[model samples]
Target: MATAAPTPNRTPPALRRKRRKELATAVGFLSPWLIGFCVFFAYPLISTVYFSLTHYDGFNPPSYVGFKNYDYVVTKFPFFWQAVRNTAWLVAVMVTLRTVFGIGIGLLITKIKTGAGFFRTAFYLPYLAPPVAATIAFAFLLNPGTGPVNHLLGQLGLPQPGWFNDPNWSKPSLVLLGLWGIGDLMVIFMAALLDVPTEQYEAASLDGASPFQKFRFVTLPNIRPIIMFAVITGIIQTLQYYTQAIIAGQVASGVVGNSGQQFEPGFPDGSTWTVPQLVYNIGFQRFDYGSACVVSILLFVVAMACTALLMRRRAGLMGED
Candidate 1:
């Protein structure tokens, strides 16, 4: 048997040209993002680590402080510990609410066929509002005496608890405020709900499954990955919460006026001081960038550790979901 010589019917020139064009197009498409990542994100992250290690204010040249900043932060500074405590509390309370209630609301809204769009939009409004505006609005609403909430309490014959204005309730108020903007998380949960195979629900219904049972057996399993994502991002987001508390703290405690009213107020009653606010006070107001960097690093570690722990927990729960 003589095999004929293989014919050289290679790729047509037109096809080769098209492939080349596609390669060029793909490269062109990705270049902008690649360039942006290097210049903006990569550079700043590297610079931050450098800045963390040395004593550098924006104005002066950085001085090498070795591990002094980290040491002082961990061992010496009570304020650092206080800020960490405050941040931890915020993370603990706010993340829990954001997860539990936010997901519950998501499931409720999804299960409601009528007015689903309206409820979704309404629930999402807070997350869309500007942080400063939202914070200020909350401050006014939560005013201890004159706020409408207190007025409502009075109308109901209830003693009005001080909200943002009280030392006891200010941190709690911030936690509650954190709950207002879980619209994004809710949306994610809604999508995960939608991903639950319709057939599964039909089966569950035939098995006499109640709504809670359906959710437990069908919905929760389908949404486990997303739930994990929500948990991770929720913790990270709460850990990085700066704007609302910043505004609240600014409004409540005087920022620059400790000596004869020269400063802005932070949480009015000395409550709701978060890690970032404390970092700002130390690094900028007190001109201690080294200490600020130390606090920043500590917060970074805690946030990362918290996120990792949650991820591990989720992994273990993966079988259940």
Candidate 2:
């Protein structure tokens, strides 16, 4: 027997109107963000990709020279590799040290029963200092001949090596600066540590687990997600590191912008030149917009790749947990 035709599955008119109104409200709320994304992010990204394949200074019309900019950056550009190396070194060393130091400080603060808020405020104050001002202050403090730090070393008869002025020590000095301002990371870790259930710790103690054992099996497992988030963000931040390095280099080299002469970044034999600094120097300083765009694209690729890898690893870790 033939089945009766199914009733039309149309929504009630009132229901449909309500749904449409809700959708309109949602779209209205989202419009500002959508406009901002298009104007600030999407437009700039598309422009960068287009410019990477062309030769253009700000005043000149773009001439398409497809991939030559990339080739020159890879092969002929003198400081490209140096910038890459410096950026990579910062990402590896600075990020690792910041993570460790942040956790250590966080743990220490958590153990403090009295005036923990004061200590947190003191630590976080350094992060509030403007980056340019901070870098300049640090450079002056470490100045080889006249700075108080070197003077103290002299009085103590310790061998005083130039910090930002020395190629061997510049990156290390930047690491120290990074650690000094790691209070943001510390705060995050502290929150995570505090969030860990005390019941787990009591349970572990009942099992006669050592402090380290409890931390490893209980605390770490509970806070693994926060740790991963910190690490990922730290890596991304380090990859785009610019201001401090440039300012430190400039201060150390005593290269204030002089009559039509641009101050070269990554002073002290190009030791502290980072990829982002390179992009700035190329695009604005040298007026090589195409090459700058190429470097930017490469940097974008590297950042995206690193983030993807870390996210995948985080997923695996969460699965294991």
Alpha carbon deviation, residue 209, candidate 1 (Å) = 2.9
For all candidates, the clash counts are 16, 0
Indicate the TM-score of model 1. 0.81
Query: Can you tell me which runs of candidate 2 are displaced by over 4 Å?
Result: 1-23, 257-260
CA lDDT, every prediction? Answer: 0.78, 0.92
Question: What shift in Å separates residue 208 of candidate 2 from its native position after superposition?
Answer: 1.4
* Location of the lowest summed lDDT over 10 successive residues in candidate 1: 256-265
Return model 2's CA RMSD, one decimal: 2.5
Q: After the best TM-score superposition of candidate 2, give how far the Cα of residue 28 lies from its true spot, in angstroms.
A: 2.1
lDDT of 1 by residue, 15-65 (tens): 999999999999899999989999997886676667778887768999988
Candidate 1: where is the Cα deviation over 4 Å? Answer: 1-34, 253-270, 316-321
- Cα shift from native, residue 10, model 2 (Å): 9.2
Candidate 2 least-lDDT 10 residues: 253-262
